[model samples]
Target: MHAKLGLFFLFLSLAAIAPLHAAEPAPPTANATDAASGAPTDAATEAATEAQSSANAGAQIPDTLEQRLLACAACHGKQGEGIAKSEYYPRLAGKPAGYLYNQLRNFQEQRREVPIMTYMVAYMSDDYLREIAAHYARLQPPYPAPAGGYPEQELARGEALVRKGDADKNIPACSACHGKSLTGMEPTIPGLIGLNREYIVAQLGAWKTGHRHGAQPDCMSQIASRLSPRDVAAVSAYLTTQRATADSMPALARSARLPIDCGVVPGASSADPELGIAVPEASGESFGKDGKDSKEPGS
Candidate 1:
């Protein structure tokens, strides 16, 4: 009995002195997470996996100018073409950079009253505006053929107004200031072609309502004021149908003086009707003080 007791004490000492070690690896994936606690390991594994996934997602999204442009793309289109399957969005691609720049500035300054545009541009700086404008101006996307049909009589009237104004109204032809083919003049005037009919109508209405504004004389306001609803509809539809010719591109230089003393034009006279200043009436045959005429090559 004493020998057995002595052997038992020896065994106990041996058990205590044996090098301590962790328990055998817990049963596979099921018990690996919490050997001490009574909980499943898979939940912890899933949580860790989720955390890793979140980190990867964060890493994938880096802030960039391209990211900022996404906001513009949402409304204007991915390429800034402004053709987003919507009627009101105009074709912004390949527009004159200066013209685009001015419009962006107008939106930001609230001079042009587009609520969405104003809100989007509220925080954009002048330099950023120029950048965005330049980006769109550089893109030359293909223009789709004009859509929708109008009455032939209205179309004829529209064409007449675009090419030759009604002599009775003292209004000059649309081509006189907007290039011979209804394209824009550099540094200010926008191209009339490749624009949505609805957009044109909307802008004309805005001008008529004094919601849209430009430089001192605001020639658009004056021009739109004289237009009847029929005239506006006719002109907008006609202009949209016409495509730009080689010469339809915006003129780089202000080669000729404006037909009337338009404040926005590069070299206009003091013919401010808005400021109570008297101006000369424009005629199809002749315009401005010099007999340069509205149909002159430079004009």
Candidate 2:
């Protein structure tokens, strides 16, 4: 009976051990190379493999114009709308593509002073800039102009400056570089319509302070230097109040008639006959002058 009882206990113990052993999965077999090298695949290696596969599956150059626009939207905002007001990124939609392309090239060439833009554009080629410009130019302008309303006094001040020259200081009207309609000229200048007040103020300030410089002799600097802080604020206010419109097809035809030699009105210094200041030739062409002709060079 004692021998039988001892055998029974041993059997019980074996049964318990057998279940425990069977519950565990077998160790995976190693490849010959891995075994020879005494190394195993790691989590990082697996992750990299997955990542490469994902990249390959999704990778393709943007083929359509809309797809290509995604590159710009990454920074500028969806639909070519500007980033938030706090960020101070400029609106690109509705701007002349020519101006946009030139600005991009300027950033790439270090002609502009924005470190972020310079770095962003450093590797981009001219073709890429043109592509981006074309994309933004085709987009519609944003509604409710970025700088919507202003105090009555401010509007009046702005209107005065835009319409009439400050003759005492020889400050030509705002309508000079910006056309009577405030739309921009093709190839270089930008339209002022629908721009944010803050953007206008900042740009003028940059020009006045020399923080921003453009292609040699910086045309904006010449114009900006002549503006008082008050003048800057007023013009900006007025521009923001104007109606924003689509790029006029007729403007392109008018651009051909503009004088090739006309440059920004220079600071109060000796005037050069060769670089004619962009003042209006006649009172009839002035911004507030009595005629209904809204068409002009750089609106």
Candidate 3:
């Protein structure tokens, strides 16, 4: 029994000394790789994967107004420059803010009847709409090349209509309200340049068919109603043939009273009978100036 006890003590001393003399092999970790072999550890691999995923997600959904408006780029363009191949979607860039704002409200209020526009803005607040309008209005992109290829006679007729009114038909010149440059008049009217011919034709037709509406007087509707199909074509063709330049910006303000009363246009009043100019009577209102020679006002 003495020898056995001595042996046990010896064994215990040996065990203790064994650990002091040499290290034991470590247990493998849950996430481990051979560092000497330069292989990536499980934790490192997972971290890299997570980082890549975050990068991809960030790319897809960046926080910016321009990025948020990507859906609009599908039709209108990235900067509201408009889609060149499409005649249906008109350019929104560089248009008057008030005009753009009005159109947005019109879509929201159902005064305008474009399903896509109405749907896009259905849930947007007035302030949101105004922001969108301002964004597009501030952008001034390069205009597309003027479209051509109309017969000379057709262009001539269009020019006559634009430059001088048809006295016999009591039709006022387009420039009378659109400005002499045909760019537009400030505060409301939109520039005619860079517009697609087909788009112009369609809008005029919409006005004529009562598919579109404006404010009380609805002068555009009245004017469109008086235009024949042929006249519409000529005007669109002529407009497309014209180009816009730096000087083609909308006029700051009207120098004189509008030849016709346009309810949407602030301060537009009836023509003076003293000048023998006839204008359409305002809706629920008559001409203030009295004259002996009376004529019909067509658009």
Worst 10 residues of 1 by lDDT: 26-35
User: Model 3 over residues 220-272: C-alpha lDDT tens digits?
Assistant: 87787777677777787888888887445666643356766676564444553
Model 2 reaches what TM-score against the true structure?
Answer: 0.62
In model 3, which regions exceed 4 Å deviation?
1-63, 269-299
What TM-score quantifies how close candidate 3 is to the native fold?
0.69
10 residues in a row with least lDDT, candidate 2:
30-39
lDDT top scorer: 3
Q: lDDT per residue, candidate 1, 128-222, as tens digits?
A: 66666668777776666665578889899999998877788876678777767566655456678877666677677777777777765677778
Which ranges in model 2 have alpha carbons more than 4 Å from their true place? 1-68, 146-149, 246-250, 253-299
Every candidate's lDDT: 0.56, 0.50, 0.57
TM-score on alpha carbons, each prediction: 0.67, 0.62, 0.69
Better of 1 and 2 by TM-score: 1
TM-score of 1: 0.67
Which has the better lDDT: candidate 1, or candidate 3? 3
